[model samples]
Target: MTSTQEEKAEIILNLINKRKTVPKGVIYHDYNDADGSIKMQELQFLISLLEERGLIILKGASRDPILTITEEGLNFPGFEKQREIDAIAERKKEEREKLEIKNLKGSVFQVKYWWVILLLNSIISFLIAYLTKS
Candidate 1:
């Protein structure tokens, strides 16, 4: 599937973070097609944006540039926000599971004491009938 510009930027940042320093050619090759066509312009634009933002340092020659992630880049706001969202989702999932387990326990209790419920219903019905008759 196609990725948004933000997503692509995040991917680039993640790669740089993992490696500390990465070759521009490595990233370019990843975006290149088997036919030898490359999305160099788009990649260069992203690199420039990152450099401008001080998230990364671009060095070496234009043809074989290198990228090094900055400390600020490691704690990128977008990544932080994503981590928070993931944590919220995980908590919601845990809550749902707990609720499901609670409901299941209630259901099991009802099932286990079905005979008592039936006996109580019978007594109540008999009492109601006798009261109405009187």
Candidate 2:
């Protein structure tokens, strides 16, 4: 099966984490196809994404960049506490939105019910007056 981008990134991160700093050739070798074709573009994209996320630093010339894992990258895959906190916050936000929607539905129902009650009362009063006058 093909690896997802996140999975591929994790592999790269792990590789860098082991040595702290690795040459680009190391990564190219690791991702080389069975036929010996190098996946240069795919590897570059992954590296760029990791760099953008501040997980790794890419240095040296464009031809053979060096990859260095940051402290954040070391902590990224195993940062359970931060992930838990974020998940909890997201759940709370979803619950609050659900409650707000329920409250809005209740308010609309009340308004419609009030209008129906007023109409019924008016009809009853008009019928009562007509019967009394006759």
Candidate 3:
């Protein structure tokens, strides 16, 4: 029986996770086929697959990193959780930003209330002086 997309993705993720370092600088030259360099392409597709799951990350072209498994990404209970975990993380970040924006929009800027604060301080000072004089 042919493996599902999930199965293929899981195999790749497990392979990378077992490595001490996922070769962040560049994929090994051997990983690619001599012909069309299709191995690199396949690895990239696999990377995208895991990223979709939220289990790995590849950032900065300068580094040309391979995605690594995340500890919290275990929730992708399925075999291909790495791909799911990335999406989950992204959605969670988006939600947090949304909630934060809502909170920010609900309140007025604190610096703008400086004049009101000054007035309150002036009133307290005036009352203290009056009591001392009395």
TM-score leader: 2
For model 3, what is the error of residue 44's alpha carbon versus the real structure, in angstroms, after optimal superposition?
0.8
Candidate 2: residue 61 Cα off by (Å): 1.2
- For model 1, the stretches where C-alpha displacement exceeds 4 angstroms are 1-3, 31-38, 79-134
**TM-score of decoy 3:** 0.40
Per residue, candidate 2 scores C-alpha lDDT tens digits across 1-134 of 13466667677778778889999888778655322444778778888988998999988998899999888888885334556878999999999999999999999998879978899999999999999999
lDDT of each: 0.80, 0.80, 0.62
lDDT tens per residue, model 3, 1-134: 12554565555555556662476424434333222343555666767777775787665563477556776444446654545787899999999999999878655555667788899999999999999999
Clash pairs of candidate 2?
none
Clashes of each: 0, 0, 11
Evaluate model 3: give its lDDT: 0.62
Question: What TM value does model 1 have?
Answer: 0.50
How do the residues 19-126 of candidate 1 rate in per-residue lDDT, one tens digit apiece?
Answer: 898899886765453224447787788888888878999888878789999998987877457679889999999999999999999999999999999999999999
Q: What lDDT is reached at residue 106 by model 3?
A: 55
Q: How far off is residue 111 in model 2, in Å?
A: 27
